[model samples]
Target: MSAPARRILLVKTALDGHWRGLSVVARALRDAGFHVIMGGMITGPEIVRAAIDEDVDLVGLNVGGHAAVVERIIAELRAARPELPIFAGGVLPPSTCRRLAELGVETYPPGSSLEQIVEAAQRLTGVEAGKA
Candidate 1:
């Protein structure tokens, strides 16, 4: 049998209520054999708790311009699980992307292909594509 799929937790850092892109990305990850857990909209503490509770290998933050919220979530997640890899998607400003890059998180701004996101997930989780 194939190995258990790597778990990825996805959350919205703000109440943007934009689910279209997140849904597509989730589907792509699932199709690529990664087990995806949708956390909806949550706070930094809630995200930290969920990440630990779910035992996810990677975390995806959806922050549509809420740079501060995203930063806080990243900080909390890093504190609790310092080695857990993280990537982000949504309407991120160039500045926000740079900040996230500095923190070692990958950022996919608007127009990033689903393929790119999936590849990043695999890279972060250390799972090969279609073998996650």
Candidate 2:
């Protein structure tokens, strides 16, 4: 029997309505054969709830706010699902990326390649790139 599909939840931490980046990443992940759930512009609690309810294998955050805000969301997600792998991408500064890395989230700032993002998703979700 074939293995079940891996699921990933994509969320925007800030209230920003820009969807171009998120859309592209989601499409790449979906094309890689993983189930991608887009959680648009939600709060930390909502993200945690959605992750738990959706039973997602990984969480991807589009961080467009201060590092502290993203940190808080990370904390919430960790509290709810400690083993859930989390990655982020957006307008992150060097310092913010460092902070998130310290918290164990892989950050993909502007100019990060789609291949790299896909590879990270594979690693994070424990699925082979094309097999997912």
Candidate 3:
């Protein structure tokens, strides 16, 4: 059998239970043949632990809270896994998106097409789509 696709850890950094954004993104990633681990409504610590424990190659954070909250999570993730690539999506405003981009965290706001997200996952994971 072929090896499993690269793993991606999908998480929500807020108390928000609205999974629409996460769901869509997760589906896109899966369709692109990624093994996505869903960490629902978790804290920053939880996110870090899951990423390490799962040995994920990429992290996709669904940011629903204030930028500061997501920033903390991003910081902790970076500190824990310096090489891990992180991408975020959700109700993030343009300013927040710019800040995230500055921190090297790619941000995908609402209405972002699934194709774009899948392409990014492939690039971030360094896994060719067809190989997955």
Query: Which of the numbered candidates is closest to the native, going by highest lDDT?
Result: 2
Residue-level error in angstroms, candidate 3, position 31: 1.2
Q: Which residue runs does candidate 2 get wrong by more than 4 Å? A: none
Any idea how many clashes model 2 has?
0
TM-score for each candidate, following the candidate numbering: 0.96, 0.98, 0.95
lDDT of 3 by residue, 16-102 (tens): 899977888888788778998998988999999999999999999988889999999989998999999999999899999999999
Candidate 1 on 1-132: residue-level lDDT in tens? 877889999999888898999999999999999889999988899999999999999999988756887888899998999999999999899999999999899999999999899989988888776678
Model 3 poorest ten-residue lDDT run: 123-132
Go through the candidates in order and give the C-alpha RMSD of each one to the true structure. 0.9, 0.7, 1.1
Per model, state how many residue pairs clash: 0, 0, 0
Q: Could you give the candidate ranking by TM-score, starting with the highest? A: 2, 1, 3
Task: Look at candidate 3 and tell me the lDDT of residue 35.
Answer: 91
C-alpha positional error of residue 99 in candidate 2 after TM-score superposition, expressed in Å: 0.4
Clashing pairs in 1: none
Question: What tens digits encode model 2's per-residue C-alpha lDDT throughout 1-132?
Answer: 979889999999998888899989999989988999988999999999999999999999998889999999999999988999999999899999999989999999999999999999999988776877
